[model samples]
Target: MFYFLKQRFSHLAIPEKNAKRIGMFRTLCAIFGGLCVAYLGMTLLLFILPVSPGESLVIPLLFNTLAWALASLWIVLAPTRLRALWRSVLPTLCFAVLIVFFFFKESM
Candidate 1:
């Protein structure tokens, strides 16, 4: 099943390098990291701002969708840069999660 999907979307597959498994891991990390960053940013913003549940849900949904699109494009077009961006963004996301976890404990 996974192989079929990979064959169908072969353009998005990482190039055959010295370590194909490592390349695939890096690609997955970038896509997931981008999603995590977007979600964390929006989740924190939701807690800090005055927003209805419906509005809050929509905001994060849109951000995650956008991130997914960008991540897919990065995987197809610029795999190398994606790894660097993931590294830079992941820390910010972790910090955001910590802030939300600590400060918004009561509100959530």
Candidate 2:
């Protein structure tokens, strides 16, 4: 079954040397970039939830673990290395911007 799937998806496979590089790239993105995105996501969740502070904090705190896990897997399992990089980076950047905007808005 695995072999059949591999053959079926042969066009998606990377060369051996590039496989290692892409794997490392995905791993690094999953760890560092995913974490950044997850953390910011949690913060954004806290801000977005229409609940009291204590309840909101608890929800994102719980969600952070699941969010990080999903983000890591999402990055690592993307179709290509570039896709993985974007999957990790784009969300992180967007979340960072939203977090900044929320903070700035709060200050104003």
Candidate 3:
């Protein structure tokens, strides 16, 4: 199953530009960068929202899951195309923001 998925994504995989094998630094950087972006985006949304304490808890969980699922799908299917990744990300972010805005507006 793993092999099949990898094969399907072979075209989207980045070609190694250097002879050096994957190193710890590169792996760490990728993980950290992804986490930082996710955290920063979530934090920004949390501040903009005016939810009650109980409601606020659910918002982060829902948004994070939705964002991560979308991001994971894009990473798996469009890895080679940075533009495709950005295009996917922007819409998801906008959707999250819109949801928050409406939720707050309705609560008021």
Candidate 4:
């Protein structure tokens, strides 16, 4: 059974072991990276919104799911595994910094 399966899919681009590792890496990146990006993106959205606190939470919360899906898709579709990680990391960091500054300004 295993032999027949191997022979059936032998023409795949990546070698067997490497492909499995890469697939796992991509999956991890998508899951964790998407969460980071989505959470940060939602907080960042708070700064842009002009509504009161009660109403403001609603929009970002609503958009969170959609943002997570898009971020996950973006990372998965990246040409290289590392690039997929970077695509998620860079924006997350940017959002973090912006949130920090917003809070700092509010404190001062």
Reference-based TM-score of each model = 0.48, 0.74, 0.38, 0.77
* lDDT by residue for model 4 (15-99), tens: 4354335576677889889999999989988877878767899999999999999999888766566676678789889999999
TM-score quality measure for candidate 1: 0.48
Q: What is the Å distance of residue 45 in model 1 from its true position? A: 2.8
The numbered model that scores best in TM-score is 4
Q: On a 0 to 1 TM-score scale, where does candidate 4 land against the true structure?
A: 0.77
lDDT, candidate 4, at 29 = 85
lDDT of 3 by residue, 1-108 (tens): 999978755643554455355434334333443444455456556656787656676677667656655454444343243434454456556656765776687689
94: Cα error in model 4, Å: 0.5
lDDT of 4 at 47: 78
Pitting candidate 1 against candidate 3, the one with the higher TM-score is 1
The runs of at least 3 residues in candidate 4 whose Cα sits more than 4 Å from the true structure, single-residue gaps closed, are: 1-22
lDDT, candidate 1, 1-108, per-residue tens = 998877745643444455334465456666666566656666666665676757777776677778666655554344454444556466566758676685768566
